[model samples]
Target: MTERMSAEEFRAIRHEPKPSKYRNRKTVVDGIKFDSKREAQFYASLKQLERAGQVYEVELQKPYALTVNGQLVCTYRCDFAFYDAIQKRNRVVDIKGVATKDFNIKRKLMLAVYGIDVEVIR
Candidate 1:
């Protein structure tokens, strides 16, 4: 039985894309690419805070090496690190849409090694 698919059906099937690597879609703003729309929104908020003088500085994608006993375990890259004038201290922020085992392990290692609490904005 040879049944021909309609043009509309063929077009729809052709246009259907595979699932993306990440759960969220990547977004670009001001020539900078963000992992997700949520991250981009957060970046906008941070810029607003800096302009409002709430935050002194905003640094993104800061990498910290998680090492143990003179051995490098893994590098934990935080989403945002900044000097918070309101809090009167530096803060590390990592907004997790989905917390994976790797992130959990690295987060624990970060605290155990550096004594820095990563602020997770889920």
Candidate 2:
């Protein structure tokens, strides 16, 4: 025979604070935790593009290191990346809720270091 747990015990075992509705709501889709619903929507669109053969591959949360003189300075994580066969190039995408000074710096560094332009989506 198995011991039954009480409701208070269950609640205590699974307690987690609810996220504030006023802030950007994080969503989990296909077992991936997106920063916001908008981002998840964009990811879904990417999936469609992949299915349609518009993009060769879709990468989520791609990380790039910004190096100066072969030393790591900072790291930039883009929201999405895809290879466009027609364009014959890789495109990096960033879904930004708010563009901060730090982000701008990293964007510029990415361009200087990697020579890849990030497409910002507001």
Runs off by more than 4 Å, candidate 1: 3-17
- lDDT per residue (tens digit) for residues 1-122 in model 1: 99999999999999998766667878887788998899989999999999999997688899999999999999999999999998899999998888889998999998999998888887
- Which lDDT values do the candidates have, in the order given? 0.90, 0.89
CA displacement after TM-score superposition, residue 48 of candidate 1 (Å):
0.4
Per-residue C-alpha lDDT of model 2 across residues 32-79, encoded as one tens digit per residue:
999898899999888888888889778899889899998999999999
TM-score per prediction, in order, is 0.84, 0.80
What number of clashing residue pairs does each candidate have, in the order they appear? 0, 0
CA RMSD of all predictions: 3.2, 6.5
State model 2's lDDT: 0.89
Which residue pairs show collisions in model 2?
Answer: none
